[model samples]
Target: MDEPRRNLVRWLLGGGLSASLISFLYPAFKFMNPPDVPEASVNEVSAGKVQDLKPNTGKIVKFGSLPVLLVRTTETEWRAFSAVCTHLNCTVQYKESSHQMWCACHNGLYNLNGQVVSGPPPHPLEAYSVHIRGDEVVISRRA
Candidate 1:
């Protein structure tokens, strides 16, 4: 076409290409480098039965607004994880004998250590720290 028309077409094409590139790159960048891991409040989470929480059993404990999973291993060690599922952030339930943590919302299953064994979980459940304080079992964030 004429010089004026050709110049206008070239400018439009370049602008469109740049916009497309930025649109694709923006999300990729966000996904690659996540915003940040939020700071979890540090407090003692008391769960029932440091004694009744028998081996291979788990219970849900709360510290302020946070929900944590407390599990008793076969070796009598107390382990803790964030009760929030890694996939959709749903709460998880505990099976005492099988030692498997079950998320009924999507049928997601995790081992006592919070490792996903089945269903659509994207990552292993986050493990925290637990200890015995006074007569209560305390679950807390690891430093």
Candidate 2:
């Protein structure tokens, strides 16, 4: 080919290779150094009304950016805990059949008080404070 045509071919090939290389490296670069994102600073959250949750049942409530497990153990009793498992940060759920909090991620069990009962969890779940304000149920981080 003529010199001009060869130069044009070389430019096109170089441009394509650079684009492909950038496409592959961009994601890895982003994965290695993620952008800083500020988390929501929330101290308290209203889960819902007292009547919304029935006794012997549990529900997951969002407290800021984290999940909070709200359980009504008895007709007049309430409990709130950080739903994250201490072992692997998995979301925990209330197991009514056994009257305990359970992390299915590794079969970790915790009592209603958030103490690690058994399994791979190295620490107890973080306990939160529950308050009854009129007919509403409010959950707050413990000091």
Candidate 3:
């Protein structure tokens, strides 16, 4: 009888600990999914007509859900950069005449080549590889 009583007690204690452990572990397991990087869709980006973009001006294009700045530095050359700011995750605005990328939230400034020349930005802007397909400008990760 004593053996049976001890066995019952042990079973009850083991079950309680197991349940508690599972409760703690389940949430951890649910939150353990690997981090994911946001990817821009390739199909949504097109040439976006050179005639529409004025030289020395930046036009914001809505490609999928991302905002991309299409800038024409010269009549022959077109460039593209992500609107996302390198510092504090703010969106960056292109300053055409100065060819500097400016973040209004702070005093962060970057050169036309996306280099961090001054301000609080620790890194330069992320450059999107761009190319011309006929009259269309293509912006893509593969570019």
Please give the CA lDDT of all the candidate structures: 0.81, 0.95, 0.79
Off by over 4 Å in 2: 1-31
Query: Model 1 off-target regions past 4 Å?
Result: 1-40
Clash pairs detected, candidate 2: none
Per-candidate total of colliding backbone pairs: 0, 0, 2
**Model number with the top lDDT:** 2
For 1-143, candidate 3 gives per-residue lDDT tens digits of: 69999999999999999999999999899899767777754544874777877888887777677677777888988777778777887888878767877888887888888888888988877677678888888877533
lDDT ranking from best to worst?
2, 1, 3
TM-score of candidate 1 on Cα atoms, chains taken together? 0.63
Q: Residues 1-143, candidate 2, lDDT per residue (tens digit)?
A: 59999999999999999999999999999999978999979999999999999999999999998999999999899999999999999999999999999999999999998998999999988899999999999999899
Q: What is the C-alpha RMSD of each candidate to the true structure, in Å?
A: 6.4, 6.3, 4.2
